[model samples]
Target: MGSSHQTVIVTFNQPGASFGQDAVAALEDRLVGAIEAAQAGEFDGNLIDCGEVRLFAFGPDASDLFAAMEPHLRAFPARPAHATLRIGNTEQRVEL
Candidate 1:
């Protein structure tokens, strides 16, 4: 992990009939793929879905993880909502 931790916060809109299970699974795949593709450092992170928002962290830090998550940034707003990834202490408003 890097000196500064990175965190990806996935804010989900109203979940579909699947009850977010599908979304969660897909997110996992996306995170793995992005990490491999980007060659990001190893870290510990998980998927956190808060009804209105779903957060995905790559590990204990957010730098490498943030770099790894670019591939999966487009998988959102199937209907109309928002998803954000906060790498550092400051919250950056990423376009969905």
Candidate 2:
């Protein structure tokens, strides 16, 4: 099979809100767990790589799949307002 690249952009509801040092640390831990889970196929989809602000996964199902992972994220100011997904050459924006 050919390679497929997927990117998920998560934006917070309150854009300027700060997460604080404690919250940021906690969030980092949770994100690491999420990435590990994705690599282990624990999520509905697979996550191949990730960064501080972006998640790189396989397939075009990022919006639906990542939405499910939202509740598990603890450091957001309110929920994520939206998610932007790029699968291969196609880009899609989704509001949450």
Candidate 3:
């Protein structure tokens, strides 16, 4: 079987029914520093319009990617947030 790449996906639920594109764009910009600081992952953009925003990041190490993005995800003014950390063939869900 092919090996799975390590990945971290942080999701923030919108307080309202949906999110504004401008806000999502701004949020993406806000995480640039964190991603760069990790020095191990790349922000693979986000998926929106589902009453939540999910940030996609992939790296050689899932832990490094999660560590870098955790704080930013926590500081965001959104409730019911969580992250899906995929390590190889396994996946773990972490509440932010």
Candidate 4:
């Protein structure tokens, strides 16, 4: 038996100009934890790496990946101007 891997990329839009540095940092930290927490249960996957603007993870498929990410997306303090979820070559813009 073999396992299939798909890349999941989460790109967050820039914060509003009024957001303070401290606030941005705090939000980033929370977002990191939320993103990491998404890897649980049957959807468990590897969080390969991340940056200030994006997160990269590998999972079995887009459906599981998105399902795991739903909560965090809903909890975001401010709706991003735009967000995107990319699984391999397929891309979907996430609206909150």
Q: What TM-score does prediction 4 earn?
A: 0.49
RMSD to the hidden true structure, all candidates: 3.9, 6.6, 2.4, 6.1
CA RMSD (A), model 4: 6.1
Candidate 2, 1-96: lDDT as tens digits: 134435565544444544344554455466557655655222222222221233333433555446545555433654455566666677787665
Candidate 3 structure, TM-score to reference = 0.83
Candidate 3 regions exceeding 4 Å error are: 1-4
TM-score of 1: 0.57
Model 4 regions more than 4 Å off: 1-3, 16-52, 81-83
lDDT of 3 by residue, 2-49 (tens): 254588888888667455778667777767778787687788888875
Per-candidate TM equals 0.57, 0.51, 0.83, 0.49
lDDT of residue 22 for candidate 4: 59
Report lDDT (CA) for all predictions.
Answer: 0.56, 0.48, 0.79, 0.50
Task: Return the clash pairs for model 2, or none.
Answer: none
lDDT of 4 at 78: 46
Ranking by lDDT: 3, 1, 4, 2
TM-score winner among the candidates?
Answer: 3
